[model samples]
Target chain A: MFGDLTVDDNLRLGAWQLSGRGRSRRKQRDTSWVYELLPDLVRVRARKAGGLSGGQQQMVAVGRALMSRPEVLVIDELSLGLAPLIVADLAEHLTELNREQGTAVVLIEQNARLALDLCSRAYVLEAGRIAAEGDSAELAASPDIARAYLGEAQGLPSPPDAQDDPGPDDPGPDDPGPDDPGPDDPGPDDRGSADSGSHDRATADPAPTPGTAKTARGNQDTTVQSARAATREAK
Target chain B: MSDFLVYLITGLGTGCGIALIGSGLVLIHRVTRVVNFAQGTFAVVGALTAISLLDTGLPHGLAELLGVAVAAVVGLLFGVIAIGRRGTSPQAALVVTLGLGILAYAVEVMLWGDQGRSSEGLSGAVTVFGARIQTHYLLIIGVTMAVFAAMAALFGRTDAGKALSACSSNPYAARVVGISVTRMGLIAFAIGGALGGLAGVLLAPMNSVAFDSDVALIINGFAAAVVGSMHHIGRTLAGALFLGVAEAMVAGYGSATYQTVVALGLVLALMIGQAARTHSVVAEAG
Candidate 1:
């Protein structure tokens, strides 16, 4: 998003692909659906994105992505530098997007607990390799994952973990493989949601794990943000 | 008093012309971070092309339009050579533009020869508060005002304007949103050339253009643009006008030879002052 641009301007830029050619006139300039997804942006859309609060800026980011009406949303660090309350609000919006719009989310995060909570299936990594890949619940409960990552990642310094932020040229791995072949349909609203979390630039990444891994079930529009795991899912 | 008015008004005309060029520099610098030395060459191309078209019996307006279009194409070529590659640094692009500007001189001289060209624009004088000035100067002022007003409206009120601005605001984010930074930079260069061309065509009546005339034009224009840090249109306008009127005043009251010295002096003084200020601002904590 352009920091100098108003929230409105930033959101409109997301629709650049649709607005260029002979697209339908109705969808060309429309941003009403984006406003609906993030209702709080209505009043402040006229304000510059740089001036907004971190949470509001995050909303603008998510709203801008939603403007593309994309099937998948990839975020580098959703909760970075944001307050916990704001993260919860953003998490709920991500869930709403996944539930209401069926937008698949790829959340690259250092917080293992947050990632496991939102995803139906997860791949836990150690030393640039997937130590475990299966149902999110089983991985969360596993002692290896708990001791290696989930339990120890809380408020701790960054361990030897893979970085987020997808490189366009080399995005790492595309598939974590169909090893477990877990549920694509977890529950009524158990579709993937990225609970906004951040690897704060000011503070160190709090991952206690050795590294990161990425895994995706669906075939289209998978955006991997992990340095190691990015090679697979991005294709 | 009328003598002073003549200098002031004429100076303002000169100022408006320089402002047009300065605005072009501002736009290109804002988007691409390239200090386009070829900016004044754009004006030269526009003026020369207009002259050639006029010789072909094209109407004045049509000739000017074609001239500006040709200049815009030249600007696109500049962008292609300067920043077409992904890894070209801004400094490298700047040097490339300087070389391209010099290269353009050869092409221009080969095509037009070494003669100055001028067109009698809006012939006759308009009387103002006891001072009679050419009607062409007023046209220059009017056109410049209209251009600036249009620019303000485009950047401030329109979505396309905002998108153009966004290319410089946060390039990475702009890319993530699918705004092509490279394409936008090219558009900026084209617009810059067109603006420079417009300035040149308008200025042809005031100052006859020779093949090498852009050397002085760019010097003055770069001075005015530097006053605004080459990124702000409003400041560039103020700077251009200040230098333009000051030059006129110097020529009127003192020596015409000292006129260009003012431009050079301003740039030198401003750079030293900024460097000194930067040094003073720097502090080390143990």
Candidate 2:
């Protein structure tokens, strides 16, 4: 994200990939489409993203990636330094995105519980190598995974289930593959990167500062409730 | 009073030229992060092209237009050589610009000889208040304002301008969003060249420009650019105009020989002050 540029400008530049041959215009999706996905961003569209709060900056970052309308959305790390509630809200948006856009998302996170909650399948990366890979629930239950990520060995109460579960109306695991680009492909067809399954990734990376105020365990309750509320509003 | 007016007005005229050159420098450096040593050569190209066209009976406006166009093409070529290839660092490109400046001197000397040339553009003088100054000075000031306003509009109100600005503010983020950094760099250089060329043609009517006149011209531009943070147009213009006026006032009221010395000395002081200010700011932020 261009911190110096307005939220609108940052999102608009994403279209440069395959739209209008560098002419600064998208064929099907307009830049306003991003504001539609993240409605809270509209008021601050003219403000520079650099001066915005971490949560707003995260919104701008995700809105920028979605402007390209990619079939495969890859988020490196989603939970770094962000408030738990903010993370949940973003995850819920991602869930909604997956259901609506049918874009396959590969979200990599350092938080094991969040990753497992958001993803059906998971992989544990250790020292640049895959340590363990399996179903999210299975990995969560494994003693080794449980000890390392879930804090089960330490006897910490299990955190409530994250927004990874789809509601009655939303379809992600059941949706058609992203590989099957429907007749109305919103993005450039030549984007060779392809993927399977569905998840509209909206990784709102809280720009790692010195560190954020600790709001982890206390916010976890509201995090779940708001995540569900967001899913409902999205539906 | 008359003497003061002459010095002040003429200083502003030269100051306008420096601002144009500095604006070019800032624009290119802001986008590409390359310090082009050949910036002054652009003015030489424009002025010489205009002068050469006079022999062929082309009108003044057309000749000047062609001169600016030629300079823009040269700027594009400079961009291609400096940053066109992958892996060309800004340091490497800066060195290449120095070489290109030398190359321009060779071409200029071969065509126009090592001697100086001047043209009586917008011939005659205009009276201001109770004093008289060249009509050309008014033209220079007018044109400079128009150019700066256009530049401000381009960067502030246009999408292409914002994207170009984005290429510099956060280049890594810019690439992630799919902006062609190289293409934007080329555009900045071309615009820089046109501005340099405009300054040269404007200055041609006032003084004799030699093959090596760029050495002196660029000194003024670099000072203005450095003092202005090399990006902010309004500040660069203000700094350049002050330098021009100071140099002119010194020439008018004091010794002409000390003009370059005075200009350079002021730049050194301004540079040190800015550095100290920035250092203190960072310390406070920390």
Candidate 3:
């Protein structure tokens, strides 16, 4: 809808039908308020919206939505096709708006890192099913979550056991143990057991990466064998 | 040279009428995404209603106003049926508009019969540099100018216009912002219908307007809009003027039967030219 309309007019249209106050007062309050939030828009108020950059247009889109004083604002793909810096700036505004206005904001984003960072609670939808849902921090710390998103859990230190199990019926006993190999080892008396213990730990965890050694063949598989040998030799 | 001036001045009258209708077409299409083949039905209906009212001894201006109002209401109804619901596909809506136009034509024929209708326009002719011009032609030109000025002001300076433009630009976003896109489409239809009605009144006296005559006006108007890519208002007006002048010249120097052919040919040539220009720009970018 970016025609030859001036940016000011485009913004005004966002709240055009909203009536209760005097026309001039409403115009002054709503438009100037938008300008206050998006200061960059103020400089280009007289310019046509059609000539604006994609980022600017997106800002206008958000500004326009805000003018309506919506109870719940839903934004789709807040980061899609946008620069990282721009997305960050927009996220800042969204946070500010949510805090100040008590506006419920629902953001749909493909960038998991940004989404998990910005939201207090998040849901991960896979094939229309919610695969995961919880406090953002809790979800981020889960070993399975880490394995799925942040790479192998063995590389990172296991956090405190606060992540909610996916369900009551499926309590994953060995899932967290692999990440805490020091605590999970049966005993220190048998030095040879450490190598077999690591092997057992890798097998117990279903994650493909650390378990790849048992399944693969060729030069890469030999390297893995040598790495295990080296670990055993060091022990 | 004087003969050329006469033809040009005469051409402007027809050009103004076509431009007004073209503007309505563009506005409706922009808002509703429907070509609205029934758009010219407004003109025919308005003219016939006004003519009928005039025969009953009503004031000419009042009759014209009422006619335009009738057309606007009719347009609003059309919009509701064609575009009100969310689930109706745009293609389906376009077909509905076409069906409505056909229905209007049949209804007009049944009501007013096949006889062409005419009105008594302002009779005085003004001579300028040896070219005698009808006062009605001047009125048409003046009225069209006024309408364009009003439209520009509405679109450029007003909140309502901006809302309308917003609906046209991004209906989903407009709805998200609480603008009723369906209502905007209805408003577009209303304004578009009024313009079409006004065009019919301006052109009715010059030609005996009948039920089927709207097709020619719609064709010329649609052709004019195509010259401007169906979006630019100023360009559409200029395109209409150019088409009118060229058609008049062909009528003056060649056979009257070639007028429709010339209009269609001009549209094709302009389309080809625009397509080539677009291709070249794309080629450069590539």
lDDT per residue as tens, model 1, A1-235: 4667788887877666565444574575688888898889999988887677766776777777677666556655554455555666776787788778776666655545456666666775544556678877777677665544533332322322332323222211222111111122111121112222111111122333322224332211332223223223222
| TM-score per candidate | 0.80, 0.82, 0.76
Off by over 4 Å in 2: A21-29, A126-135, A141-144, A153-235
Better of 1 and 2 by DockQ: 2
Per-model lDDT: 0.72, 0.75, 0.69
Chain A TM-score per model, please list them.
Answer: 0.62, 0.62, 0.61
Q: How much is the lDDT of residue B255 in candidate 2?
A: 98
Residue pairs with clashing backbones, model 3: A1-B169
Error of 1 at A107 (Å): 1.1
Instruction: Judging by TM-score, tell me the better candidate of 1 and 2.
Output: 2
Candidates by DockQ, descending order: 2, 1, 3
Q: What lDDT tens digits, residue by residue, belong to model 2 across residues B45-102?
A: 9889888887689988889889999999999999999999966888999999999999
Please estimate how well model 3 matches the true structure, expressed as its whole-model Cα lDDT: 0.69
